[model samples]
Target: MAGSSQKDRKKVGVFVQHECPLNLLPREIWSSIAVMVASNSIEDLFNMQATCKEFLGAASSDAVYKHATMSYKPLAHFLLHLDGPERRFLDRCVEVGNVDAILRHGFVEYLRFGRRDKGMELLARASTEGNVEAGYLCAMLLMFDHEDEEEVKRGVQMMEVIRISRKLESCSKFFRGVFNDAIVLLLEMFASE
Candidate 1:
């Protein structure tokens, strides 16, 4: 009976020693997989991280955060009130040049908090990174808010590019609503001036 138990134990140990094929994949491949998972659903990425140490490492990559489609709704709440982990996650996304993160933070900073320069800088960065909504907002700000003729001309050119690209037609309704509200606010600001 003791000899039979020893043989079973050895078989179990051998099975445990066999590595998963996934564990053999390169870190770059894992990172790419993590990015895809993150883009699909950040929640899934978080769940993946809990699966194993290897997945946790991959999910923590900056590339994952950069490509992740974070929920903008929670971000709005975070903006109004600081939440530690969420704030840190937002900061990581922003640091990695996540376009949506930049756009949201820029919009809030510029429109809500009156941090014009910083907001414009972030907006411009997001626009340069291929966010059509940020491009539109930046053009609007440059055209209406700046007194400099050169800045106005640049804004006009930017708007022209956006129109030529037809990106505005495909933009999300949420962004369009935000854009319209911003236009109204800008008009009010100028009217009061």
Candidate 2:
């Protein structure tokens, strides 16, 4: 029994050493080690990412989900309902670019605080593109409406700039108008300060 216990201890030591070897190791190997660790605390998870690119990439899976969870409970909970492939695709988004990451994190702000016109325009575009996932949210927003909420109402008015752009016949002109309006609005807001 003692001999068997010794073997088990040695096996555990080998696994630990293999994961976080003291000797200089290749980047890929080091990253693989980082992934093997199970972290329960958010602080430890972030610390692991800061350790190296391999760790960052390895933790990207947890990081993306964690970021979403911290930013929006509903969005995170909704994502959990997705099948395996969609979840895998989201992990890929974490690796490919920050755009998806930022959008996911900013979803609540867009939903609750963005100007009504801007939010509606964005939803219309999403609908036109056949984004079925956005359907439920689009319907809910229209039903509840931001006008009833003070903070959201402010965002709705600020977003009226979107309407001015919609008057143009050309799609390009419309976008250009939005860009110009954004710049002007920023300058005016800054000047007021």
Candidate 3:
């Protein structure tokens, strides 16, 4: 078999070792694994991407993108250059009460697609569920994007509500710090009075 042609080896029933362990996985299984990482950690994403071309493609597969969402800048940036069938994957982010998903979806709608009111609505939906970041974003959007005095006033009211909500204060001190900044904006708003 020495110096045999590539076909000769196959005739002898030689098992060829090809690709890495992860890459050897069924595309569906690999995508399943990759999707699990897409939602929570960029490092996990990069790790999966480093495995092989198969894994790299799997990392960006719609199954993974569905869970990952465009909230991640890389995913959003990647999706931007894509066309047709892949664009549908962008909206697959699950809506099952993941506040971050809600806020991130809102971010994409406003920043990427320029759908201001649509984005604000998504953020407001998250905020209503007691997400601090979502509330903060909703207030900011209302304040900056809307020219109506009523909208700014509504934003200010939102800030004040977020700042003092005992439910938020009790659960997340990190968010409490963020929510408090609303008071500064509120104070600045009222100071002109």
The candidate maximizing TM-score is 1
If ranked by lDDT, best first, what sequence of candidates would result? Answer: 1, 3, 2
The 10-residue segment of model 1 with minimum total lDDT is 72-81
TM-score of each: 0.68, 0.30, 0.46
* Per-residue lDDT of candidate 3, residues 24-56 (tens digit): 568898788787777666567777788778888
TM-score-best of 1 and 3: 1
Report RMSD for candidate 3.
Answer: 10.0
lDDT (0 to 1) per candidate = 0.78, 0.44, 0.65
Clashing pairs in 2: 115-155, 115-156, 116-156
C-alpha RMSD in Å of predicted model 2 compared with the true structure: 16.8
TM-score of 1: 0.68
Candidate 2: Cα lDDT at 41: 32
Which candidate do you rate higher for TM-score, 2 or 3? 3
Candidate 2's displacement at residue 40, Å, is 9.7
Better of 1 and 2 by lDDT: 1
Q: Order the numbered candidates by TM-score, best leading.
A: 1, 3, 2
Angstrom error of the Cα, residue 167, model 3: value is 11
